[model samples]
Target: MATFHHYPFCPQSRFIRLVLGEMGIAPATVEEKPWERSQSLLMINPAGHLPIFVEEQGLAVPGAAVIAEYLDETRGLGLDGRRLLPDHPADRVEVRRLMEWFLVKFFEEVSAYLVTEKIYKRFMKAELGGGPPDMAAIRAGRSNVRYHLQYIGFLIGKRNWLAGPDLTYADLAAAAHLSCVDYLGDVPWEEDETAKAWYARVKSRPSFRALLTDRVPGMAPAAHYEDLDF
Candidate 1:
């Protein structure tokens, strides 16, 4: 079996996890703290990041994007579910665009702020930059999430999925980030019913079960977190 080094509440890491789950791959996971920057983790990925996917044969894939692509290329097809990458060139481009938008734009503007300020700061050791949470950063991230949810609604209205007719990596990436924020109960789903409905659909997928059931030690998920109807 492959080994995955990642942390709970990490958006990028969640993306890779969902991809692996969707592909029916069960990997042994090692939770790592990027802030601690362990020497062993650095040896595998100089970037000192979470989510280093290592194969039993010693093939190591660092970074969520690389791991996702690797899984897609190697075990993307002939599985129980639909392929995460689209077959058509244009559709693939759209999926890539949406994937980058969520992984980068959404994270930079919103998810990262909340994850860092709320989760990391609360649990991480003070020497490693963890302490009291930053309310201002959390506020900014909460405000920014509305726009991103609207965008998801817009995309879902046009296509059956985020990228096209099939549920691609774009949907998984978006859900991964949203799932992190949602755990903190930051998303204003009630403000946008369409987006809430769309999320409800994605949340019911078999691949999302693990994410919904995930718990972060002292912290608890929202009342509606594991509620498929919510």
Candidate 2:
């Protein structure tokens, strides 16, 4: 069996897990705290990142996009109507476009903030010295999240889903980050009916059930965290 080292409630970890589930591959799950490096993580990926994918062939894959594509290729997933990438070339371009948007732009503007403060706070130690999450940064993330929600609302209004006609990697990426925030009670679902409806669809996925069940030691989930209908 393949091995995966990751922390629960990690967006990148959740992203690959969902893809693995989609690919019909099961891995031996090992929980890893990435604040400090370990010999095993070093062996898996010299960079020592979370969400490490160790394949049956002993190939270690790092980064979510690369891992997603690798799993899709190896497991014959993300094809036809069931594809995780968009079918049309233009739409495929758009999928990559939004994939970067959520993974990079959203991460820089939003996920960095909330995840740092809420998720990484107690779990992190001062020796890491990246500095404790800035309250201003977290507050800004909360503000930016509202605007991001509005943008998602507008996008969803224009197209049924975040990427295009069918659900794709962008959808999962967006959900992955937002679920991290939503788990911290930071998402305002009431802001947009379309976004809310879209969320319910994302939440109801079989890939998402495990994420909803994740608990972070001292933190309890938000009121609607586990409610599929929410």
Candidate 3:
């Protein structure tokens, strides 16, 4: 058995959780607040990041991409054709590319602003720069998200999944970020019905149930956050 250290609202953490859920591996989880930079977390991952996966052998796999790849090599073998990383070289590259698009590019452009300002700030202490949400950042996030949604729609129009015909880490990564944005009511789902429909499909998966049930204390999810049909 492995142990997973994460923050519930963290998109990267959520992505790893979804991947583990898809693989049917339920590890014990420790909720972490990355902003705190707790010594315990630092000991395992000096980067002070969420989503650290610790193997039973005491090997600590820090970072979401590292954990995802570790799981693919160590646990995904049993999934056969259902492996989240496609076997073909080109397909594998596409999956990694989309993973980067969501986890890195999308996060930097949208989720980083919204999640940090709206959600994390609410829980952070004043000394740590916590206070009222930054409306400017929020507005920027809201405006930028429309473009990403349109991109999702464009991709879906040509492929069954974000990367290709089969579900992959690309979908999980994109859905992870969107789920966080959606939780904050920042995602403009109506702007792109294709993206909305694609999200609906991912949101309805068994692997997504845990995320749908997540509640962030003072901030409740949007009205339609958990609605399968929405």
Candidate 4:
């Protein structure tokens, strides 16, 4: 069996976890605090990032995008029609585009601020920059999330999923970020019914159940975080 090193609240980590679940790959998971910069973690990934994937052969794959692609190529290809990535060249491009949108753009604009301030900071040491949550950044995350939700609604209006007719990494990526924000009680779900509805569908997936159960040590998820209907 492979090993997965990750943090519960990290969106990128969550994305990989969802991908693994969807692909039916069960790896032993090790919770890691990137801020701690443990020597053991550094030995595997010098960058000391969370969500590293270690194969049974001791090969360490770091970074969320890289791990997602690696798993898709190694495991997903055998899943036939159930693969998260599309088969057509154009469709694959769109899937990658939306994956980037959520993993990078959405994370930078929304999740990074909220999770870092509200969740991660609490667990970090003062010397490592942990302290009271930054209200300004939190406000920015709260405001920015509304726009992203609107974008999701717009996309869902046109296609069954974020990238197209089938569920793909795009949907997983978006859901992973939103799940983090939702946990912080920062998402304005009422402001975008379409997005909320789309999210409900994603939330109900078996692959998503584990994420809903994630609980930060000192923080509780939003009341509706685990409600599939919400």
Give per-model TM-scores: 0.96, 0.92, 0.97, 0.96
Write the residue-wise lDDT of candidate 1 on 1-230 in tens digits.
Answer: 88999987899999988888778888999988766788999999998877899999989999987887788788886255667887788988998899999989999999999999988787779887899888889889999999999998888788888888887889889999999999999998988777788788878888888888889788999898899998
Q: Write down the worst ten-residue block by lDDT for model 3.
A: 74-83
lDDT (Cα, 0-100) at 207 in candidate 4:
88
- Displacement of residue 230 (Cα, Å) in model 1 is 0.8
Return the lDDT, model 1, position 11. 91
Q: Residue by residue across 1-230, what tens digits does model 3's lDDT show?
A: 88999998999999999898888899999999977889999999998888899998999999999998999998884233498998999999999999999888999999989999988999889999899999999999999999999999999999999999988999999999999999989898988999999999999989999999899997789999999997
- Give the per-residue lDDT of model 4 (tens digit) for 38-85: 999999999887789999999999988999889988887423357798
Clash count, one per candidate: 0, 1, 0, 0
Off by over 4 Å in 3: 77-81
Candidate 3 clashing pairs, residues 3+ apart or interchain: none
Strongest candidate by TM-score: 3
Which prediction has the highest lDDT against the true structure? Answer: 3
Q: Is candidate 3 or candidate 4 better by TM-score?
A: 3
